[model samples]
Target: MSGLTVTLQFSGGAELLFDKVKKREVELPALEKFLPQINKTDWSLRELLVWIKDNLLRERPELFLQGDSVRPGILVLINDSDWELYGELDYKIHNGDTIMFISTLHGG
Candidate 1:
């Protein structure tokens, strides 16, 4: 089987770390490329994060990624809906899906 292509969007200052490309389509290789331990055919957001960190992220990934997922103040939206509504990092990304990451900065 071929890979899945999805749209990634960065905003609310998240784009700064991604070379200022607000939106881009990425073709994620087969899940086996990332997880060869099992027969999983879907890519989870957690896996996607690792992929972005390795491929797309051009700057400090620490700012955009914390641990295994996005930083605390970064909001994740899947297809215009809150990612929380769809299990956040556990959400299985599909082809053509639009995933957006928005950073929330607090001024002191």
Candidate 2:
């Protein structure tokens, strides 16, 4: 909480869990508490995945679009549906609104 100003939630590929935040300007130890071991707090959403070779099945982090390279596997829901369907990351957040990040299942 001391590191990040915004709130981050995890789900879909993971489970019902809340995140310890890390600020855009600052990196803190608390960041590792919520995310998977492969998830680098320093890397952006996209970069982290590629760094780990897209093995994001159970590995996910609460990511802001600015931080990393977001791709198809990562479904970022601002309120409900895709944030891109709404307005990409530019979509503003209101009080008490929840954002969800789900990994897209590829093979049917």
Best by lDDT: 1
**Compared to the true structure, candidate 1 yields what TM-score?**
0.91
- Candidate 1, residues 1-108: lDDT per residue as tens digits? 346899999999999989899999889988887768858778989888988998999988778888999988999999999999999888989889999999996547
Poorest stretch of ten by lDDT in candidate 2: 17-26
lDDT (Cα, tens digit) per residue for candidate 2, span 22-89: 11122223334545564544423233233223322233334312244455566776557767776554
lDDT of 2: 0.42
Clash number for every model?
Answer: 0, 8
Which portions of model 1 miss their true places by more than 4 Å?
37-39, 106-108
- In angstroms, the error of model 2 at 57 is 15
Write down the TM-score for model 2: 0.39
Q: What is the lDDT of residue 84 in candidate 1?
A: 91
Best by TM-score: 1
